[model samples]
Target: MVNSVNKRGEKILIGPRLRRLRTSLGLTQTRMAEDLGISGSYLNLMERNQRAVSAKVLLRLSETYDINLSALTSGTDQQLVGELFEALRDPALGRDRVPKSEVEDVVGASPATARALVNLHQRYTELSRRLVREEGADEAASALQGTVPATDLVRDVLQRARNYFDPLDRAAEDLHTELELRRTEPLTALIARMKDHHNTVVRILPNDVMVDMLRYYDRHSGRLNLSELLPASSRRFQIAFQIGMLEQRSVIDTIVERADLPTIDAKRLLRTTLANYFAAALLMPYGPFLKAAEALRYDIDALAHRFGSSAEQVAHRLTTLSRPEARGVPMFFVRIDIAGNLSKRFSQGRFVFPRFGGVCPRWAIHEAFASPDKPLVQSVEMPDGETYLTVARRVTRSGGTSSAPSQSFAIGLGCDMTHAKRLVYSDWLSGNPMPIGPNCYLCEREACPQRAHPPLGRALAHDERARGLSQFAFAPDH
Candidate 1:
């Protein structure tokens, strides 16, 4: 009873929380007071915690606002505790006033203080980030004057451009009218139709003719020389890019300019990327495709058949279901070569997977390489106890019609387990099977023998017991 009633223990920073909630609810103190059946001054005092929130007032607010009191209270308190922790991270203060756990306890018990702390902490973080970037820029610029190398120029552009498209982005928008290509899937049906309409002969050329080349464009004769080893998907992409380079050069340039991309290299890469997007768009038009996916419960094979695409294509298309009019199953899609090289990652959903290097071996994505030709769907449980539903299959990558050897790649589609029921993979979760793994960054399971690298955010402490079962015998709690 004492702990529950301890006012000091409640980390209530209610003033900011009250103000935020009032703003969110679109209410002034007078209106809020009227709603609460209290005087405006009394309402103001309550927000400041000069007046304790009575049980009756709390109940009324909960009912009136259509919110759970515990939730509103805890949310604010957690935000506050986080701010306090961030402040405490700066070891300048001699900290003996209150125990950290007690401070956390108060934050949990009291809602108001937590909200203020979070708000304050966020502001501080932003200021700190700005200061660091500004300082770094000033010092670096001063150190290297007239001789700003190409690498430095690239860094400047990347820094200013936020590492995404610039003029290229605007070009993509402008090209929508000219090329009529969706941002994700860029190719038009007309382009695909031209193959039959114009008798566009797609010849499987010898790799020896264009060694280490993906596609060669001969605009004069309208010939698309694709490496024979390229997969069907690759061949189509190469052909469409050939079209983009040949016909859609203007649109590609517009996107490059819109994104503020450094041009000398942009002409080569951006055009190809936009062309592939156009091709993908052509295969899976947003509206009809997403509708089909929802109707079919996001079945990859069904989508592939409907679009005349490969399983890998369907998985890739799953990333772009973000259109306002049409949305499909939102999942993270990845493609990895047999050598474990990450070829592509299409992720726009909530989660942020690593952008560089290899993924955790323990992840089910690696399993596709082992069982080529077999499509698999598995319910994955990460080392950190996070479970995910993953759909994986092995796909072969060819160098087109040429003798360029094809390399096998594994395509994986996954979503958080909480979102699994919405997918067509619930059936895979019912049966029990051995989990195969060795994911370095994704696995949090300390006991995993296959973990090649420690998870990015985990810390390990060396324990006296040397014969632990896991690879890194150190023990640390997240």
Candidate 2:
């Protein structure tokens, strides 16, 4: 039964995953079947999706090949499928209509080819933007020669690792324990450690003195200056971040090296990201934080208060609790600005954010802008019928001056609905979940007044004699 249906009560089909695993292990159908004590014909049928993988077969596969059951059943392929579909839907491609089922089939059959196509499309899009912005032929030719953007490369690295760096986590935890952060205030302990270990003096400067920089480490003066604009939580985080840069440089560099990134900019960005991860781990050590989260029923405010972190920090940290031995609920986190741009995203779960465009307007994350600083909860069902419990709230970053206005963004955190009962926010869940899509260009939801663009590959259905709730209508059946 476990292999028969996923948490959403839908029949699970892991043919691609099973075949990929077998291929990775260098096992033929007969060999793997022998290992699992199943007939070769049965294995072939399972690999071809002609037969459902029984629980016994799943357990046998896990026991024999040493695979995580979640890895086999998770919706990881959906991200690749969605990205490939979006890439093929590009107007510039000028290809005939490609159905989503065909896209999924392509991913299932040959994920490597699908990923290559998606990567090519990304490069093409980046080059196209550069061509639009710059008129010079030399500049346009240089743009065409550019590889994937540094940001995208760094994001791909993080996503591939599932945002969890075990070595960094363990190192930060060890440091936290050695410093006895539990006995004293985190900021004070961090400051003492910085002064004692690194001979760095932590200072808070006035807004005028710091000006635009939130944090600046003066190497010659041995002073780490933090802007007065930062709150207590931010100051602690910045101090920890500096400590990480000094202490964890080797470990961060090793990780970046192993990632085999293409450009210097990508390496630098990844190093900073890893340092931020180390900082969060130092503030909220994995063991204590995971325990407190469970005790508080995954309450964001409670966890933030307990760890002396901000809501956004707490949400980001939640996505990194993917330790094999002591795992927390798998979750996804995203940050969106008022203009509907996704500034940040990380997932240790099945949910995938749209790669190129804005998110679905119906998502509660957008509604959080209306009631800033207050948390909003909703149960949302994607077009694939997978449901998730999402929590969204507005977080503000102060500029500390009238001339420099503050910036506000919506922070979204979500997990599969199956894990919703473990969260305190589940109390707000409604029986009817809001139906949403990845984005307007990919969504086929009809009569949505919030629909900003007609779905790609679907012909617009215009009739002067009739009007509907949506301004741009399309054939849903298409």
Candidate 3:
């Protein structure tokens, strides 16, 4: 579909977006204007939506910041539109429904106001949830309940930073350059580097001795031990992760310091998280990886084979392809266990994960486990109206021996509908996307047969005369 062109032949004015990008990078209006070859007053007008951004200025912004121009402007509205739709469906809104056209007009004409509306909706939803919970809690317990979940805090830290740490990316890139990680035998190179530089010998030990551990380092003996059960790709990753811990300590420490994490455990987790990211970046250098992904149409298995990495590693790396100039399709990568516990999540796209409950069972992430090792692709629409094309596969951790325990989880990689055509999996999909929700508590879908709980702010109604598909039927707010 062609984007609508303005009188100046510019494709829509994303003024709030330009302002956001400039502020995100801590750039002044004057500095941004100078960079874009425009006067400060003109830039101000553009930022306020009084003046549309020309194609030339858009090109300059894209080239200068290494940003995905389409994503900056066009991809900004789906989430807002979705949230607005959800808000309008609230019982408090009564039977008078707000039209989708009005929502679209609000998003297009004044995106800042639309964003503020979304924020207010989110706050109202959250406050309603808390109010409901507090009604049942004692004074002291209710006070304690206000503390944020550690997962929520970590998520916020990653989200606010857009899941891309420039310093870490630069460090990984520099390390890749210095080590020449894109060689015919990159794993061998990494092993040699570990041995020669870090004085750490990488050993693959059998499962019996290394029980209950995937990878462990004996600091005193200068040995990094790995389980024999691990596949070749995992073995290589463990080695590189150890290298990151040893060599990239300062970089990881600096990042953790900058995060101002709440607790020691959060710091430790962030450190490990940074190391894992560094390992992925090292294995798949951004430029070559991005090129191969585009060439292969982002076939996860193909890219994994080309890069000599695991499917999970490749999927996770895809989410990190947020470098300004060389961005890939914005994606959300999540790993959920069979029991529906989210172990890992990162999104350049705006797929919201539930903070306080299980993910909606309707999501393919949970179903992927039924056909272990097989990839299942689906087009899913959230209750609010945003759609995504998601690919999910179950990954297993070996226990070396058949009798030993193995852990399994499903990894999901998804991009918004606009980018789905680029993926090979989309060929089999047809019709509208399956309607799903972020979670039961946060979901306001009144008729979802799979809903496990009533949505926040919507009170449950007792009806002897009628039974609905959902167990927790809600009545309109009085």
Backbone clash count for every predicted candidate, in the order shown: 58, 0, 3
**Candidate closest to the true structure, highest lDDT:** 2
Candidate 1 all-Cα RMSD: 22.0
Error of 1 at 462 (Å): 3.8
Residue 230's lDDT within candidate 2 is 91
What lDDT does the true structure give each of the candidates? 0.60, 0.84, 0.79
Ranking by lDDT: 2, 3, 1
lDDT of 3 by residue, 367-394 (tens): 8888885788889998668899999999
Error of 1 at 433 (Å): 11
Question: Model 1, range 1-478, lDDT digits (tens) per residue?
Answer: 1122224565444454566678888999999989989899988886776765665666777779987666545443455666676665542233345556766755654455656665776665444333323212545444332333333333443333333343333333344445454333433443454465444555667767768876765646756677756655566566655554555567666765654543455444555666665556545655567688888888888888776677877786676565444445567777888778876665433333443346666566678878876667877654345567888889876553444346788988887777778877776676653353324544456677765666544676666767466666544563
Query: Where is model 3 more than 4 Å wrong at Cα?
Result: 1-146
**Candidate 1: where is the Cα deviation over 4 Å?**
1-214, 227-235, 262-267, 382-386, 400-405, 431-445, 455-464, 475-478
Score candidate 2 by lDDT.
0.84
Better of 1 and 2 by lDDT: 2
Poorest lDDT segment (10 consecutive residues) of candidate 2: 132-141
Candidate 3 lDDT (Cα, 0 to 1):
0.79
